[model samples]
Target: MGEIYVDGARCQGHARCWALAPETFEIDEEGYGKVIPGRENSGDELNVRKAIRNCPERAILERSDDEAPAKNEEVATS
Candidate 1:
């Protein structure tokens, strides 16, 4: 299985992640993005991919369970 993460440093509150996957992503008070707990693996790979690809900041990422730690400064996961 794969996991989704939101890079806090890279997130610019563009909301592309939330727009593409509302159930998986959310915008915080500061307008930055956060991954909704337990929603990252909602089995909606297509939308997740869309969120990842559409992020202007490239903040959304998908990593396989066995993959090494993500490169983001801060990784938010469900």
Candidate 2:
């Protein structure tokens, strides 16, 4: 599982992260970023990276375990 974190103070209710990866994140009714329960450490590299890149506030962060990070594999451009 990959670790993901949301800096609540930095979130601006943009919901970009949710839009990018609905399976991984959601915006609360109060307009702050919240990680969907049990998704904090999901190994969905593609979706997680997409959310991080799409978040306008840059509030999202990822952490990998002690193991070496994954090598870059080609992903098709949308």
Candidate 3:
């Protein structure tokens, strides 16, 4: 599986990533890109990669396989 990361500080609010992969990415009201909560890699890899590549500020990141956490793992809630 693949995991995606977003650099909020570097985001330019272009909405390109969100536009390309709405299922995997979401844009805040301010227009910054976010990897949909708990869905960093739930969508197609090609689509995610496209979002990453299309990020103008290079704020998007991705890690694959062993480097990424499993999607089914339980999340600890406070």
Candidate 4:
């Protein structure tokens, strides 16, 4: 039940997020990775967490429902 967002500035077209969570992320035509529209807040449990940790660019960010309006640092670096 966590929420994920991909930082376009940090994303260098690496599809690691997509590879780790296809159902939650997708690579755009330009090859940059993005969270699938509605799936950004999906319940991936482990895959999405892996995506966040495995992202070489550290582009993928997550915030739990309880952590609103907080910075990415507020969220644990799973």
Candidate 5:
């Protein structure tokens, strides 16, 4: 399975990630990105990667299999 992470401090609230994958990402009350739970991986690896790449601030992050967690991030959404 895969995991989603976001660097809230780096997030500019551009909403690009949310726009690309509404089912997986949303804007929190504070305007930060909030990822939907239980659907982090869900086999939508390509879409997840797209969302990550689409992040304007490059705040979106992904971890798969045995890969180490990316740097300077948190589980802001999931």
Candidate 6:
């Protein structure tokens, strides 16, 4: 599974991510993009990548299995 993170402070409420993958991304009541926890890897990887790339603010980030942090504590800390 992959992980998605959104820097809410950088979000401009453009909602492009939501438009591209509503199932994976949502706008909170405050109008910022909220990457639904645990749902990031449920959708198509290409769709997720496209949505992240289309974000005007570049607030969206994705880490795939191969790119994810190692399970070791030292690796996580680093």
lDDT string, candidate 6, 18-40, tens digits: 89888789898878998787785
Candidate 3 local Cα displacement, residue 63, angstroms: 6.0
The window of 10 residues in a row where model 4 has the poorest summed lDDT is 64-73
Q: Which scores greater on lDDT, model 2 or model 4?
A: 4
The local distance difference test score of each candidate is: 0.76, 0.75, 0.77, 0.81, 0.72, 0.78
Worst 10-residue stretch by lDDT in candidate 2?
A: 68-77
In model 6, which regions exceed 4 Å deviation? 42-44, 63-78
Give residue 29's lDDT in candidate 4 (0 to 100): 93
Query: In lDDT terms, how accurate is model 1?
Result: 0.76
lDDT of 2 at 56: 88
Query: Which predicted model would earn the best lDDT?
Result: 4
Write the candidate numbers in order of decreasing TM-score: 4, 1, 3, 2, 6, 5
lDDT of 1 by residue, 1-78 (tens): 356788787888889888888878888898888889877565357887788878999877666655635545345542
> What order do candidates take by lDDT, descending?
4, 6, 3, 1, 2, 5
Question: Which digits, one per residue and each the tens of the lDDT, describe model 5 over residues 1-78?
Answer: 457767687898888878887778878877789677766664356676788878889897666545645443456544
- Which segments of model 3 are wrong by more than 4 Å? 42-44, 63-78
TM-score of 4: 0.72
Pairs with steric clashes in candidate 1? none
- What residue pairs are clashing in model 5? 35-77
Score residue 70 of candidate 3 by CA lDDT: 50
Task: Please provide the root mean square deviation of candidate 2 (C-alpha atoms, Å).
Answer: 10.5
Off by over 4 Å in 4: 63-78
